[model samples]
Target: MNEDQENDMIQRWVRDTPEEDLKPEDYQHIKTLGSACLTEGNSAQLLTFIQDEKNQGIVKSMGFVLIEPLVNEVVKKEKSLEHCQAAITHLTRVSKLFINHIMRHFFVSSLSSGMTFLLQLDDRKAACVGLVLSALQKQLTRLPVPYTKQLEEADEYGLCRCCTALADFTKSFVQEIKSKNGNYVGTTEDEELRTELLKFCMRSLRELLLDAELSRDRKSSLWLFATEIMVTLPAIQQSLSELLFFNSLKKSIQMDDCQSKESRACLAYLLFVQLITIESFPAVFSPVFVLQCNMEYINQLLSRYAESHLLKGLALYAKSLESVEDNSLPVSLLELQSFYNVPQNLRHILTDCPMQHLRASGLQVFQLFINKLDSEAKHKFFRCMLKTRNHAGVEGYIIKNIKNQVEFSMKPGNASKWFLGVEFLSLLGLVLHLSQGAETDLLNSMDRIMESLNLLRYLLIRDKELRSRTGVWEELCRIKDDYLKMLRVCISLSRAYYSAELKALKDNQKIKAKDQQTDCVLCRYVSQVLHSALVTFDLMESLIVRIEELTEEKLKIPN
Candidate 1:
């Protein structure tokens, strides 16, 4: 047939076919015509046909069919860079148009097959990899926003499917690398391909993470996918080690004049933090991986960017790992020591460069670490807290900070004292945890508890002053009385609870079975700790009552 006649027939087929009615044969026919049109410099008509909303399904299907062959043709011996670029450009456009509907099958087939062909041509691999990443990023940019019910559903399904495809492509690529291993020693071209592939994967995953528009759920799903692939595939480890981790470290160490080195270091740390914090694969990620990655080297990088978000990220990452239930994961004592030092580092950060969010991050990490401590470690950990408390300088920083915040809020015409009161109460609870054993350990624990109670007393006095200034002294006094009553009730309940726990421990210890002694030791220790905690709570409540009464007496005796 003549070219015009053939073009007319293709147009009729596109215009006439109902999307649901089009069979696989019809899809092939459409794909063939589309490829022919591109070859004849008729891409405008092809694009126009594909852009129609009604033809999107068919067009998407045809895209799946056309992508592989076009990529294969570009990587052929007869093809040049221009042909490859043109093919990728066309694929990139198609990807954007139908990205939301692109399935895992399409991604896996095209990427795995296309990468296989492209790996053969060393000179063109970088250009081809760039185009591949560009196209993938464009598709990723079209992921459904996880807002509405329908969109969220679509987002979950699409993200999971895309992740599966990427995982499959990674598996195939890694397999190829393994098969070609040792056949050509120190081949720069092979290294280049490996580097490009790793960059593509890391960049693509990082793009998903850094896209503020993407919902947390979507980002988390992508994170899980990346983590799974990285952990399960051994072949990619070399590239990850060389290109993603060590290369960035090397650049950072050199401290080149260019900002790219710092940028790369930041990206490397970000990716590392993401990998370690994948909640689903806690067991899969061995503690040895952290050691293997050279924690000291990572610490050096962190030190260089001490004031940057890197420290905050590390703090948060440590916090995330604190909740893992499994103890078999290779968290060495050295790693724990490193984590223990976070509060000290944070103290420095707070002293030298105090960013509020970073301080909050540091405090969060400290709190999580304390919560994760075993019975054996509690004493040591508490000693560390005591040292931190002392190193933090003046007393009442928490109370002073809260008072300043309250005063600042009042200036903005926010007279709500209830939230402020509740916040102070919560801070008091954290202080209680910090000084749990203070009654028994007078030198370390009791002093900290006294400091906290003094802080709380100051807060109550400050609150009374603020209420007087706001002309709601009586109302605020009533609220304070009510909160005091609640504290009394809490102390009473804690006393009863601890008493019962102590009795239970005593009863359990009386058991004669040899095996029961070990259990008794644990129970006795827990009961003793509970008794001390209860005493501290009791003392704290009494102090609050006395301070409230004294403040009330002082208020009534106003000049």
Candidate 2:
């Protein structure tokens, strides 16, 4: 259309009585006028049209349409640099007008749309878009905070969207912008964007980000964004400490009505796990205190069936326990409930997790946590596992570690003497008994039986020392005799049962081969499993014999 015809159409549309609700066609026509302004190099005219008294209602309803085309024009690659620069300047004016005029009264969703688009653009094109936003930074800085109360009032006019977009924008420069004597490098604009974006992240942590009602996907995404900013900008760590302070953390301690407390816990989890390096973790809050404060949160996450939550919880625990000293623990074991609860969740992960890698990771963390404790803690932990944890695989692990601690304590000057006393013998008694006698399900108790045999063998091999301990050798001998006799009976019965099954499967396989039928794949699998069980029993019997030999050898030696 010619200039006069376009101007006349614009005037007619802008001056027309505002619709109660704009039709789709009305939005299209408004966008067409915005495009016309860009084409005519008079982008100011669109803003003027919005500013007109008659079009105030239309502008409030559809001002976002006016800004959209200006953003498009700035990002248009075919345009000359001069043309793009002009478009950016006009976009700045339109943005300011929208934030001041439309956003105050109604939420403007497109306020961050240009930014989202810019993120996808080539560097040069994005730079042009950045210039547009840079001009609007003053207006954006004036927008209300993104917390719920203010959002309820006016939605921060899309400031949340802006913050998320700027977060992505800030990430690209993180590696390039190095700190020199505490001042940031890069352009004035990047430094400014980083400062403003950090403020938004911290505020969100205090408010919007802390809302417990936030979806898991949303919460995780926000966490990643916030972590990137904090990691890249080390200076913000101190500011983050203020919000995540131990004393200030009491608001969410009960975790009943407060979403912020839970949210704060999540932030702490991410910071310590992903953002803060292990060596640099602040000494102000003891690792135990951090663990205590976040114990419920950690347990809640670990209890979740999702692999993501499980992994996140594991990472948090690993960091929380990294710096903790055995001596730093309180005198009352009751105070260590959180530390106590971790092993059960770790057991669940080990036995129940469908993912193999995650199970391996859980085991590594579990063993590391166990190794960090002193001998007394290890003793109590082993007893607790034997009593409460019914899973044989888990019980076997506890027994194995108990055996390890015993060996460690026996070494000269080891300082871990708790495992060498009457308490150790008592702990040993709980796990060595075959509760159901020979009728026990050998397949089910495979791990427990094997580890128990190893523990007995180790004790027997250390007979030189035990014989001098008075009553210790006699008690161990009795425990060994009873345990081995019952074990021999159970192993014989199990080997007989599985051996028959294996022979039957082999016969079945021969019949299938003669008939030229599909091979009994299931029969082969059953045979393999049965054979493995029989082999395991063989290992157990050998262990029993080795223990007896050591006992006989020790008897010949004078005390």
* Model 1 score (lDDT): 0.50
TM-score for every candidate vs. truth? Answer: 0.44, 0.60
Q: In angstroms, how far off is 364's CA in candidate 1?
A: 3.4
Query: What 10-residue stretch in candidate 1 is worst by lDDT?
Result: 249-258
Off by over 4 Å in 1: 1-25, 35-65, 77-80, 94-97, 112-130, 145-157, 178-184, 209-224, 228-315, 320-363, 366-397, 400-453, 456-559
Residues 268-293 of candidate 1: C-alpha lDDT, one tens digit per residue: 44444544333433244444454333
Clash count for candidate 1 is 0
lDDT of candidates 1 onward, in order = 0.50, 0.63
CA RMSD (A), model 1? 19.1
Using alpha carbons, what is the TM-score of model 1?
0.44
Report, for all candidates in order, the number of backbone clashes: 0, 0
Model 2 scores what on Cα lDDT?
0.63
> Which whole-number lDDT from 0 to 100 does residue 64 have in model 2?
52
Report the number of the highest-TM-score candidate.
2
